[model samples]
Target chain A: MNSMVEMQNVIHRYSKNTIIDKVNLSIQSGEIFGLLGPSGAGKTTLVKLIAGILKPTEGTISLKGTALRHLAQMKNYGFMAQSDALYQELTAWENLDFFASIYNLSRKRRKERIRDVLEMVDLSSFKDQPVETFSGGMKRRLSLAAALVHEPELIILDEPTVGIDPVLRRSIWEELYELKEKGVTIIVTTHVMDEAEKCDRLALIKSGKVIALDTPQKLKEKVNVTSMEEVFLHYGGETK
Target chain B: MNTFHVMKRILIQFKRDKRSVALMVVAPLLVLSLMWMVLDHDDSKLELGAVDVPETMLEQLSSDTLDIETLSSSKAEGKLEEGTLDAVLYFENKEMSLLLEGSNPNAAGAIQKELQSLREDQQNMVDVEYYHGSEDLGLFDYVGPVLIGFFVFFFVFIVGGVSFLRERTQGTLERLLATPIRRSEIVFGYLAGFGLFTIVQSLIIALFSIYILEVFMDGNFLYVLIVTILLALAALSLGTLVSAFAKNEFQMIQFIPIIIVPQVFFSGLFPTEGLGTWVQIIGDIMPLTHGAEAMRGIMLRDASFADIQWEIYILLGFTALFTTLNIFALKKHRRL
Candidate 1:
């Protein structure tokens, strides 16, 4: 598989301590790459660096062999934050509408994309409701819908399913798989073993460093573990 | 383009937060209305009870503010104790003793001011008339223009500061920074967003104070609205710029006394004419001072817009300067 994104020798610090420590990684095109780590393990910080929200303390991140600083690559990426980042005061449709404008989609395309994303999230019935009234699961799903509203080829989601129910989570995963089949590369950060199991490739990270990288089955087999949880435990060193 | 999105979110957020919405529109109007009623004097008579007043003192105490009745010494004491009379006076020749009910400060102040003004009138101090107008100026008349400036400064300072602070704390600010949207657009967007409301607010406050409350508008109505609105914009910009330094709403409110009160002191309600030269100079630096001066000039002095053009320019200058700082302030979120 060809690389769609790469982080080369990235180092980011928070005053006294480093959050992402000289890490180097590359993600293949059209695959769901999972960053598995506990909370405070720099998952959101790392994703923020990739999204160009922060300039890495040292080194660079590029998308499709082109630096994200270039207009084309920046436009081709969709980023979903760990927080919902939804304007609770606005209706679900309004939230999507406002974000869609930033992407510069034509009116016709924006409307259709909004309809598609709302339907995909199973929130079309409540599209006119204010997001402040949405349940935590609905808000998370709405955030995901906003990320996909622009239909970019590369999507980055930071802890996208934190408060989602299993049934809805499964549906969201199905949608992710469908997007992957259509050659959309995805990066998701999660500490949940079941969610990590869904990614085509997994990177086990600890204390701002990636400890292992392989396919879910391959990594588990390589670590002589039956479950993704045990494989992460093995790599994260929860055993003697 | 994305600035519109941020602005729309701001307006919607304000609408959703009913407490602030009420504060923005309702609170100022409520206080102003209270001030109007409190300041307006109807020249109504108060029942005065006198106990054994010498005939000479009774004649001197006869004024429109009082309807005096001589009571037996015991009856006068009873009336005073029962609150049947506002005051009970006892006089024996030139030695008079006055007893006043003092539970409410306003009632007490009214009695004292009336007595003082009557005494001055009797003593003949050029009748002490105001050069521009009569002494009939009411509570709203004295405080109306200053209150207008204060409301605009106060609410804009609060709403603008807190909302911008929220943007930072909520992480949406980081998301917006990640976009290609420029910093000036963010500042401009806030100006437009809050500007929309200030226009309506200024119009309402100006109309109510001048036309409804009859707070004395000697100058053009349009000039009054213009100065008030411009002040609101400057306050909004200054507030948004200050928000960059504040981490939360509490810190945002800390700016009120430091930022808003000093402006009021210099804005002319208090006598700053005799203040130390540099002390009075501090008032010149605040946008509210120029605004209040213009408002007072227009409403009280009947001055034209040209007479206050420099004031307008000074206010506009503050708006622009603070707006520049607001844009630059966004650098705290993103280096660019």
Candidate 2:
């Protein structure tokens, strides 16, 4: 399998403390990958480095066989930031239209694709609604829709469903799986135990280091655990 | 820059935030219009009262200059107190008594200046006077053109700078950066976008000041338009350039007293003759000094294109320098 992203001995530090050290990770194409960790476990920092938003102090990252020296190279990969970055005064269609224009999406294509994405996020009925009027859950789904509007090959979602209802979260994951079937690489950072099981593979991270990397079944078998919570505990080095 | 994208975005924002755009453009127009009404009130031939004046001296006074209404001393005093008569003249006992108009400073200054010049001309008989402009030009008329330029530069700079800073602090800037667009394109896009509305802004202000306010349009109106548009360019560039350094709108507003008010002090709005040497030097580097000088020269003094050409060049140079510095400043946004 071709590795979509290759990280070799990446080291990142903030201030004097080391946040990540000599970490090696390879994310391949056509898979839903999850980074599972507790808060402050450096999972967000690791994904941000792979997305090329942050450069490693030591080591290199190659994407699709090209070194990520140019930040625009990473632009082809959609990134959903932690905040819902929609303009409050702008309508949903206006926000999406601006994104489409900024990505240089063609007029005809933007129109059709905006409709498709709005429908995909269940915001089609509220196209003219200003983003300020949107609920927190709705805003998260809208941000997700913006990241997927261009239909890029790779997507990096930083805490995509924090306050979302379980039913809607399940639907979003189902949509991610559908995109995976169509050959898109997805990377998600989450602390939720059940969501960790949905990924094709996961890297259990703690303190900026990946403590475990394997399929969910293999992780459970390796630790002789029946639940992801127990797997997290096993990787976290708790005797229980 | 993709001008259409930038322009469309601004137009939408204007439509949504009509209050801000209107405040920026309309507020200046309202203040200027009030200034015009207060300053441009006409002074017809003054109905002065003269008593016991020599026939020769009284005949020598031009008919166009005064009406020469002969009234009693008591009547002249009453009219002066009521502000009906502009002045009263008496040459009894070889002592001339003059009563004056006291309401507007410009009217008093004009009358004093004209009488002084007329008195000097009378002292030199059969002498040719090589006068350039009328000695009786109103003070408002003298300062009006510079005020026009000042208003445009002042309003555009504050509005654009604060709005751009708001974009940065509100996380919209980071959102924009996440897209597949270059940093320089974003800067240029803002310039072109804001530049479009400010063109209409500049035109309305210049024309209204010249035609409606009658604020002394002496030279070619087209040249006035050219200088204004160029000055707008300078202001716009300065606005975007400074926005890079400001973290919030309040910080942007703080730049006004530092960056803008000093321009007024040295921009010919105030007399700078007695200013400290370095203060005057500071004015020389400011974009407003050039813009205000060019505007005053063109609209009030009726100076030709050649006279203001150097000012135009300096304004353009200021804008270009600010834009280049702006590109350099964007390095803070991204290393590249």
Candidate 3:
């Protein structure tokens, strides 16, 4: 497998305060890579950098062995922000169609992909309903469908399951696993311990720095802990 | 192609928002009709008391728009004081003395104009000819073009600005930037979407004002539409560019006093020529000033397209400048 994204000594600052500090990581293709940290740990910033929505103050980020520069390179990834960035006045089908068209998909392909993504998110029946009438979970599902409508190679989800219930969260995780099986690289940011456990690999981040990185089993065994929370606490305390 | 998609989504959003459509199209006509009602009326006759005035002079003053009554000097003074008479006229020692009830400036000004015209008529009766509008034109006719331009600019500013601001607050703007779409595409897309609606809006307003309300239209109706559409486009671009600085809907409303009201003062609602050069220069920089000017030129002065082409260029310039600034403003969300 090849590395989908690589960050080298990446440092980001907003005025005098550093948001991302000397971060280095490699995300493998066809893997569910998770960035686990408490809030304000620069997880969102790091993903935004990798998504090329932001420019790092120092250091470089490369995707698919090439530097992220041209806008055409943005076609490789799909981003689902913490906020469900769906147009409330538009129907679910219209929203998906819009996102797909911005990716320059043909009319027929956009219709087909909109159907597929809606089906994948189990929102096929709600396609014609306005998003304003959707529940929080349904809006989240539609947001995920928008991100996947174009069949992007890399999918970056920032706290995708925050307001979702356990049953729906399980289904979303299952969908993520299904996408990974199709060789789609997935980068997920989460603060939930169990959600972190579902990732193929985990990077424990604290105070703008990654403290530990490995699979969930290896991270637990190396820290001599049974729970992912203890492994996070051990790594976090060690960093302190 | 990406721009077309953005434009399509906006049209879809607009289709769902019927109230906004009504506000943009119908509100202007309602306000204009109200204005016409308030400004267009036949002149009221003033009540005048005459004492010891010659019969020939009294006949001259008694032509129209005045009610003359013969009374003693004391009785005339009493009538003027009691407010029953707008003015009291008498001659003493071959000189005329006038006593006026001065509480209402409009009434006082009307009496004064009657007296001044009487003096002028005594000297030599001059026939007045209009170069543009006739003497029958009311205040509504004079200001109607400016008000039309104002309504278009004002509604487009609020609606377009608030809608674009919603994108930022709702996070759809960030989502849009994350796509491979160019920033110029977003700006142009908004222009095209809102531009189409403004064309319809301009047509409806121009027709209603010219034919329905009957506010002194002389030039071709198409020129009025063209000027209004350009003005709305200028407002749309400026509103979106200004929205970049606003954080929410309330803040967008706060811009009304700063951005929208001042333009009304400069939009030829009042005469800017008597104002200082610097003040006129300030009016010159505002988009509505040129819009109102071009609108008045077309509707009142019967100006041809070539006659108002300078204003047309200035309005186009404003739209282009604000649109480019808006494209730059999107850089705050995504550097690309």
Candidate 4:
């Protein structure tokens, strides 16, 4: 598979403190790549770096063999922030319509895409309701719909299912799998070990460093552990 | 094209928020009406007691602003002490001794002004002619234009600043940055979006003051609209730029004392002439100062566009400067 994203010695600093130390990764196309780490483990920062929302203080990042210097590079991916990020005062359709328009989709295409995403998220009935009236899970789903409205080739989700119920989480995962099958690159950041196992390849991050990078099954077999949590502990122990 | 979308989103959000629309258009009219009731009243006539005054002098003192009463010296002194008379003029041996109720300074000053004008009338008999405003022009008329600029600046600053701050705090700004939209597009979107409402707001407030409240307007209505719209644009851009430094809505409000109140002090509500040069220089930099100057020139002096063009340019400059700064400020969120 071709590498969809390649990071070389990416170091990000905020003022005097470094948040993302030198890290390197090559994410393959048509795969669900999971970034598994505990909270504040620089997972969000890493995804943001890849998404081109932030510039690294040192080193380089490139997407599709081109340097991530152009603003047009943002068109390649859809980002769902950890926060729902939906406009509370606007209805679900308005929110998705806004996101779609910003990506410069034509009015006709925007209408069609917005409907498709809303239906995919099972929020078709709630399309006219303002997001302020939505429950936590509903808002989350709407946020996902907003990200998908533009039909980007690469999807970057920062903890897409943090507070979601099991049934909804399963449905979202099923959606991710469908996107993967359609040759889309999905980058997901989650601390949940069970969720990490769902990705085609996993990068176990701890304290801003990648402890291990491999398929979940391979990492488990290498560590001689049946549970992904034990595999994480084994990898985490070796780094210490 | 992206800017149009952002503008549309803001208009939709504003439609959903009805209270903010009311606050922008109605609150200013309410405050202005209260000011008109207080400051636009006819001048109060002073109660003057004249004792042993000649008929000629009595007739001279007998003007509309004074209620002259002939009385004995003792009775006049008693009236003055009781605060029933503002002052008593005691004319004896061809000299005058004045007894005054000195407790309230405003009343005392009015009495003194009546006497001073009477003395001037005797010396020169000068006919007073107003070059711009009439003698009938009330305090509300003198300050009305400045208040119009002030209300527009204040409300636009608050609503625009708080809304932009909400975008940041709510994380929508971050989501917006992740899109392919340019940073300048976002800033321009806010300008155009908030700008439409400011245009409507300025029109309503200016028309209400000129037609309903009947504050003395001497210039073209279009000029007044132009000045107010530019001032509101300045406020909108400055508010968004200031929002970048603020962490929350409360912090955005904290800027009022630091940003809005000082502008009011310098906005020609009170004269800044006697103030130190540095103070006037600070006033010169404030957008409201330029706005108020242009507004006053247009509404009171019947100034042509060329007359207030310097103020117009300064106001436009402030808007441009603030807008550029706002574009730069978004770099803190996402560098493009």
Top TM-score prediction, candidate number: 3
CA lDDT of each prediction against the hidden true structure: 0.82, 0.80, 0.93, 0.92
TM-score winner between candidates 1 and 4: 4
Tens digits of per-residue lDDT, candidate 4, B228-259, equal 99999999999999999999999999999999
**Candidates, DockQ:** 0.39, 0.35, 0.79, 0.81
Would candidate 3 be rated incorrect, acceptable, medium or high by CAPRI criteria? medium
Please give the RMSD of candidate 2 to the true structure. Answer: 5.2
Per-residue lDDT over A95-123 for candidate 1, one digit per residue giving the tens place of the 0 to 100 score: 89877877889989999999999999899
Rate residue B221 of model 1 by lDDT.
83
The 10-residue segment of model 3 chain B with minimum total lDDT is B119-128
User: Can you give the TM-score per candidate against the true fold?
Assistant: 0.88, 0.81, 0.95, 0.94
lDDT of 3 by residue, B108-162 (tens): 8998898988888756867779999988898999999999999999999999999
Q: Candidate 4: where are CA atoms >4 Å away?
A: A237-240, B47-63, B67-95, B119-124
What's the TM-score of chain B for every model shown? Answer: 0.82, 0.76, 0.93, 0.91
**Residue A2, model 4: Cα distance from true site in angstroms:** 1.0
DockQ of 1: 0.39
Native-referenced DockQ of model 3 = 0.79
Per-residue lDDT of model 2, residues B1-336, tens digit only: 344675677668777877878876788789888876776665666667777777776776655756787778888888888888777778888887676766767556656665666667655767455233354466667778788788888888887777677777766665666666677777777778777777788888877877777676668888877877777778878987888877777778888898988888888978887889988888899998998899888876778889999999999899889888887886665444
lDDT of 1 at A191: 90
Better of 2 and 4 by TM-score: 4
Q: Positional deviation of A5 in candidate 3, in angstroms? A: 0.7
| Model 4 per-residue lDDT at B51 | 96
Give Cα distance to truth, residue B87, candidate 4, Å. 4.2
Q: By summed lDDT, which 10 consecutive residues of candidate 2 chain B come out lowest?
A: B127-136
